[model samples]
Target: MIEVKQLTKRYGGTTAVKDLTFTVDPGQVTGFLGPNGSGKSTTLRMILGLHEPTSGTVTVEGRPFRSRPRGLRHVGSLLDAQEVHGGRSAVAHLSALARSNRIPRRRVDEVLERVGLAEVAGRRIGGFSLGMKQRLGIAAALLGDAPVLLFDEPLNGLDPEGVKWVRDLFRGLAAEGRTVFVSSHLMSEMEHTADQLIVIGRGELIAAESLEEFSARGTRQSVMVGTPDTEILRDLLAAEGAAVRADGRLLTVTGLSAARVGEIALVHRVPLHHLSTRSGSLEEAFMELTADSVQYLAGEPR
Candidate 1:
């Protein structure tokens, strides 16, 4: 497991991460979420020892990463997959990493095949497409078969099939009892993939919990009713404290359940064509939760 306790980082007058505390347990996929300039990459860098925290601590298995001489054997990561040398072949890159970390050379070939890069193993990275480069980066991460993995925007340039493939690949890794932590800005993609979510904004932790519990926090369940007697039903439901809004022949009623709304319509002798409870979508709920935390605001048209 990875533990972050009151971790904070500063660059001159600007603070990137602030007093953040969280834990990433094994055998699950934890998604780190935030918008642009929300300090996600900064936090990831601190965790990987690429940046020093101004205060507090982050540890993997009860110690700082730099304390381990064979760090790659404990944690595998793909941060900025495109930050590789374009002059080197995929095999050469992995081989170099393996040699430095004392990993077997055959492990390079195994990881290349595992990430579907064996066919292009000898090809220079400059000739690889964005998706292929991403695959090669993942192959390098898996070369050591480490117990923990971290990926940042792993689906950035992949097609739909490639996106799904990577999603399932992370899920499978977590099922094998590995610690998988991925970061993404896309909530819809995360909704389909992550079992747990850690959401932050402007360097502050907004939420950290299971996806179900996070989604459940936005359950402002409302009933949508369509009837010819819209005006009458709207007034009746309003009088019953149902927070009713009328749009054409439809009444959007909140602060009440579907059954209560139906009973009110029946008792009031109103005809109903449609009555359905609208549960909040995760995206909708997320917008509501982080509406204030959005750092970049587009201006209205002139």
Candidate 2:
């Protein structure tokens, strides 16, 4: 388990993380989410002892990570996949890390194969593609076989198959009761991978809760009704005080449940061609929650 208490970090006059308090429990995949410039990377660095907090504390298994001897054996992290010696072969890199950390050399081969890099284990880091580098980074992290793992943007350069493999890998690690924490700006990926979510914005805590709970904060449930009698259905729904809008053949109805909408249509002899309820998507909820926290905007707004 990992615990952070009132954790804060600063760089001169800038604050990267605020008084954030949260816990990452084992046996679950926790997704760390935020918009650009939200300090997700900085917080991960603090947890790994790479960045010292300006105030407060972060501890792994009840103690500071920096206080641990052979600390790499307690927690493994992949902060930057490219932060490796370009001249070293994958085997050479893992071997050196193992030797210095007192880890057995055999685990090096085991992890290389586990991450599907066994065929390229002897290849130089300089020639690897971005996806291959990510695999190598994951292999390095697994070399320690630590109980806690931290990954920032692990899927940045993965193909569809690689992405699926990574999603399964995270779930498998959590199944073994390890604390698996991943940070990414991709909500669609998180929707399928994470069991829990910790969202932040502008270096401050926005929410910390189960994925279900976080998605529950989305806009009220709305139903899409399609009918040949658009004109009649619209008038009837509006008469019931439900907000209704027409988009092509679909009538997007809000402020009423599916049953209510269907009942109203039937009462008026309206023929229904289609009807389905759509609670806002995870992406929708995330945007609604973090709209104000987004640090930048694209081209001119509509």
Q: Model-by-model lDDT, in order?
A: 0.89, 0.92
Q: Quote the lDDT for 298 in model 2.
A: 87
Worst 10 residues of 1 by lDDT: 293-302
Clashes of each: 0, 0
Specify the highest-TM-score model's number.
Answer: 2
Q: Which tens-of-lDDT digit does each residue in 1-302 have in candidate 1? A: 88999999999999888999999999999999877778899988888888999999999877888887887898899998889999999999999999999999999989998888899999999999999989988988888889989999998888898888899999999999999999987778888989998888889898999988888795587899999998888888888888988899988889989999889889989999999988776677678787777778789453
Each candidate's TM vs. the true structure? Answer: 0.87, 0.92
- Candidate 1: where are CA atoms >4 Å away? 224-256, 264-278, 300-302
